[model samples]
Target: MVFGYFSNKRREKMLQQLSDSRPNLTRAEYVNRLVKKGFNKHQAEIVHDVIREFIQMDNFSIYPEDDIHKIYAVEDLDDVELIDVICKKLNLREVVQEDIDELDKTLKIFNAEYILTLTNHISV
Candidate 1:
């Protein structure tokens, strides 16, 4: 009797886990829900598909950094660091950052570095 009781309890617990893991909703039941809410099957399916696609989030696993955390600062930083920070702000798009960084790096090397050196060398 004890064994049977433990077995039943284990089964109930397992079933509860499964139910929590995935909401068990059949397509027909979903359709019925839509119909009651004044949607035909075709319309409901279209709307459902769009919602599902949005929720499903099928995309490239490699997100460009920005989607995770945003970075905002007005200062000077190296190219790679700037790219990573900008990617964090721009939803991880590296291409734009790469182009901008190239221009920034070149400009710094050609003129800004000289200007900074001169400014520092001056005495008050």
Candidate 2:
């Protein structure tokens, strides 16, 4: 069978690992942990960048009003704007069409419904 980008078991394992390490960890720290766990430097960096962008785009914040505001703000992002934001948040160099495609694909794999809600301005 042709599995998705990440197999289900691997996905679950990664989620568990992230959950275990999330507390008291910064983005860089978490990425470092992933690197130590056998993720390559590039993979770890992409994972870090994507996770941080996901956190920023999440509808839940410290305050309910902030959550609502964030949802609306994120809903306004076009694909290019979204990519730009993710790239800026990640401090990535040499972002290209392939990078954006990879980001979009990864996000879709993370949560298909989320792409519809957050990126209504672009066709995914």
lDDT of each: 0.37, 0.41
Residue 31 displacement (Å), model 1: 1.6
Candidate 1 residue pairs in backbone clash: 64-92, 66-88, 66-92
lDDT tens string, model 2, 85-119? 54454454434565446556545432222322223
Off by over 4 Å in 1: 1-23, 57-124
Tens digits of per-residue lDDT for model 1, 1-124: 9998997577556545644665555446555665664544654444334333422323211111111111111134433443343333334334344454445554444121222222222211
Which segments of model 2 are wrong by more than 4 Å?
1-22, 57-124
The true-structure Cα RMSD of candidate 2 reads 14.2
lDDT of candidate model 2 versus the reference: 0.41
- Residue 100 in candidate 2 has what lDDT? 44
In model 2, the Cα lDDT at residue 62 comes to 18
